[model samples]
Target: MLQFINPLLHKVIQSISPCVLCGIDRQQHHSLCRDCWQQLPWSKSMVQRQEIDIQVACHYDYPIDRIIQKFKYEQHLHFQNLLAGALLQLRLPKIQAIVPMPISNERLVERGYNQSLVLAKMMAKALNIPIWQPITRLQQHSQKGLSRLERIDNIEQQFQINSTSKLRYRRVLILDDVVTTGSSIYALKQKLEELGCQKIYAACVASAEI
Candidate 1:
């Protein structure tokens, strides 16, 4: 009976944490206020990412853009549930695990968390799938300032698969916060492909069309 209260306590603690999107007492909407809850984007569209099939949940505009800025730069993590809900709009493919694009150690330390990882966990919970952390960033650099070509070039060799990670699954879903040139996700996807990950699907909150 020692662990019986554990679930109760967890539920209580979660109940008290106010909604991040609207700062309300609404617990039913995954810590999002009813207004913000209704604003969720629910569109599934195919993305143009070379030969690999990609899907995006939203158009990367307005409130999502603003909230994503706060979520990343402002260190607001409570929006994870909201972001996860946004990602659920995508038409999921058959995959065993949801893999988040990893951030460099320096970025993780500076941010105190990896936004992609947070989103991945939320996605996994919503999708009823497992989370895999196979992709590792070997370099410590921000992709925001880099141009498309530079991002493509710089991302090369910056990511490598963790040999210890059990990635025997044939299909996997990749998650990212924002996609610009699709370079970073591409890099991680390539590494997974080399490791025998045959079918890959990717999802992101926002995609920049150039």
Candidate 2:
């Protein structure tokens, strides 16, 4: 009952609320005004990293970068709708579930939430698909000053399969807030493949130059 009412109530609230970005115009596109939404640094294309092609909605620049930073580190969760909206613009593949990038327990404790999961929930609700998390991330460490190969190795060690789950999906999409090296996505993909996911696709709200 709440699930059915929540979306309708949200739409009503959004209809009266001002744009989250500009705070001038009424909310139009995913809580942003039309101009603000149109002004986003849209890429709506694929970027290659770690030999994986990731669909991205915008370039990590200007407001998008700032928005992500705040959303991830500063608890500006209200920006999630806008960020999720960015991802929705992509030409996504047909998938049965959405796999939000997992965060380490340490990061989750420090941040109070996994930012990727927050975005994924919105995406799942919008797309009417279930969220799947068959992999768990171990403690994460800084990759600064590391070589590309070292960074990949470090990230690959963090993901481990959650053996407790018997459920499996063949076609799934991995969702993340940003993609830079794509090492993390690649690592997650490898783990998902081991879990019998035949078709794995990845998408992000933004892609940064690496």
Clashing pairs in 2: none
Give the Å error, residue 169, model 1.
1.4
Best by TM-score: 2
Off by over 4 Å in 1: 1-28, 40-42, 142-150
Report every candidate's CA lDDT: 0.78, 0.95
What are the per-residue Cα lDDT tens digits for candidate 1 across 139-174? 656667776778777886698778887657788988
Error of 1 at 9 (Å): 8.9
- The runs of at least 3 residues in candidate 2 whose Cα sits more than 4 Å from the true structure, single-residue gaps closed, are 1-8
Query: How many collisions between residues are there in candidate 2?
Result: 0
TM-scores, all models, native as reference: 0.81, 0.95
Worst 10 residues of 1 by lDDT: 25-34
Query: RMSD (Cα, Å) of candidate 1?
Result: 3.2
Model 1 residue 165 distance off true place after TM-score fit, in angstroms: 3.0
